[model samples]
Target: MDARSRLSRAIGTPVLFCRHANRLYHRRLGLRRCNAGGVDPFDADWDNLLVLDACRYDMFERRADLPGRLERRESRASTTVEFLRANVDGRDLADTVYVTANPQLHQHRESIEARFAAVVDVWRDDGWSDEHGTVLPETVTERALRAAEEHPNKRLVVHYMQPHYPFVGADADFDGGDFTDAEADEENVWVQLLQGRLDADRSDIWECYDANLDRALPHVEEAMRELGGKTVVTADHGNMVGERAFPIPFREWGHPRGVYTPELVDVPWLVYEDGPRRAISESTPGERDAAADDVVAERLRDLGYAE
Candidate 1:
């Protein structure tokens, strides 16, 4: 172990050390795996790619009642940043238009602006839900419908921040706090569950997860119907709930970067076809609206990412 890790282990809480070790362990694992067997969404056949954030295959299989051919595929990464780094960074994709609700993509704004034909940052718009601490799937659906009409000739990639955290469904009360507040154990639902710091049970947590998916499915279905093309609904990555970290005897909580475990990497690939595939075309890259660094950080924190 490195000196920083040793010192952290010496002075920090056991959970803190485990967090560091787990990241180091899995980052090494990812280097060996190198995302060798994962599916690249760009190479897949689809006119519209709907990315549901932090959604798992098994949960999608059990809860998603959308019409499509659903199959499981290992993702290229275990976290949103890793996903964007592996699949989107340093690529020229001027034929596509991205509509996103997650603010994590801001890190790649320059690349995204230089590559994609257009980027609709719904998160920057008035789509954010301060009450729920996430951009509701319905808001994304509305923006996606408008984007589809506006860019009829371009491939659309709409990313929804749902079925993830700050669960805003009927079971939203299970874990309630300011997602944008300063970092604390209670602010992160997954960590709370992981450390036994919450009063809720595992099954209850699953209900909240399922309810979040339920909240997003209708909006996803709306997008599928209105977009009118080959739409593939998949996730950027899957969430880890009580899954044991491999080669380590600890139960992992949220999706950690570089972790290649099934709970964190395996995601749903639900392909649904409509009228016809879009005649996507390459065009001049468009400008993307910039958010202040503090705003981006606050929104990311709302999504359970701590600096």
Candidate 2:
């Protein structure tokens, strides 16, 4: 009936002294319920947008800064807020869809697979070693592109286990070198932080990461070109490498719990059209010259050109 009685009933606390005290505090602060019911500000049209799970914002930022990386049409703030709001409200954009490879969504796999039947194609890589340990090689983007082409009318949802871990295979080479155990450990920590394990030594870890980027980008580029859509690229989270001088210091590898710092939270996003304009740019004399030397160098280096 009274504020004191209501407070007691709401909190289920029998202490009059504490209840009275809290009432006084709320009165002094002039707190009031603005709305009796929860109302959503966003429309139910979010299901139309293509959602890529496990995308990190920072990684997307860094990738966008690269020389030949694709460009983005949306502002970071808009993207972040929209994504967060949609996720929180469980609203699906009418024209959009979501595709992810996170193990947590295993239960929903069948539904997702069936719902996006035309666009979604699950590729299991049998021998690829990613940050998550041993994974199937077919999960890579190259394979995803071929799958996307198979369904020309549908938008694609590609999930690649990249730069994630185990850094396996000759194709997984970083900075033209295979990673040593110590080096791999060090790099792993760096990636952990970049994906957001810890918060500090990002600069140090970034060097090794940049090299890995050099390795992974080509595959990503090829995939984007093949998809030929308004491709949005990002990571689900980032890693922390030697940030705070704290190595994983444990037998277990990959992103540990609560390591979801901003590093892991950030990701890269790019959009490119696979039409005449992109073709013209690729064929341009200047574009050809710039990409030519770099392509040859990367190929030769990967192929033991010098060795």
Candidate 3:
């Protein structure tokens, strides 16, 4: 094993080390990354890839009114960082430019810059919404459109952090902004629901989640119209809301990495073809500016992730 894997296993032996434990559990179950027979999205044919963060196939199947041939695919991981490590990190993607509102990419920013043609950090570009505590879908849409115009020869990957958390839709009640200022337990709704601290019912949470997805679809459609190409709208992974975990039979809340439940790993693969495909050619890897560690941590917190 490599040094990282060895250290991960050592740290994962303790249940208290949640992150390492999550990784170890997936590894032990033969479900980590490329091991679970999941599709490697980069291998798929597309000129543009639109990723909806924490979006489930079932929810998307029922709700999304966009034009496309929709299908289902098992994702390589159950979380964004895991997906990045599996499908994006350390890869030669100099023909592509990624425009993203998801700050989790900051963890892999260095490697990403060395691999892709360019990366537009929407979060750092005033895309973050102070009122929403997360970047709204519209911000990602506008940036992606600009990226498409700027890098006409490259493939595009637009990742939108929506239907994920902070529930910024009209019906959402727990729309707390500046999550860094909130109490630790209260900042993450999923954590609160898991610990029985959240007062809202599970069904209500599901409704709000659906509402958030509803709020993003129009923006997604708008981007698709503006950036015409052979585009695929998919997700990094799906969310789990009180679904029963495998073997242990415990109910799962949120998308905790390593739990390869269908609710967390199954995602939608919708293809929308318009205009001609871009003539993609890889030049050399490009330079990129990354947000600071403290800034990324704060953004992650605002996006409902603990530092």
Q: Cα-based RMSD of the predictions, in order? A: 3.4, 16.5, 4.1
> What lDDT, from 0 to 1, does candidate 2 have?
0.36
CA lDDT, every model vs. true structure: 0.79, 0.36, 0.79
lDDT of 3 by residue, 1-307 (tens): 4557756754754332443445566668444444375799999999989999999999999999999899999998888888888888778998999898887777656554337888898988478887677898998998998988888899999999988887777554543332223233434767666555556667777888898899999999998877887899999999988876665555567887676778888999999999877888887766667567988877887788872
> Which prediction has the highest TM-score against the true structure?
1
The order of the candidates by TM-score, greatest first, is: 1, 3, 2
> Candidate 1's C-alpha lDDT?
0.79
Per-residue lDDT of model 2, residues 1-307, tens digit only: 4555655654653332332343344234334211112122222111112233323455556543432344222211112222233232343322222233223223223233222333232312332233434333245564565544443443445555445443333233234234422233333433333334434333433544454444566666666655554554544334444333122222122332222233433445454444532111111111101223453332222211111
Evaluated at residue 278, the lDDT of candidate 3 is: 87
Candidate numbers, best lDDT first, in rank order:
1, 3, 2
Q: What is the TM-score of each candidate against the true structure?
A: 0.89, 0.44, 0.87
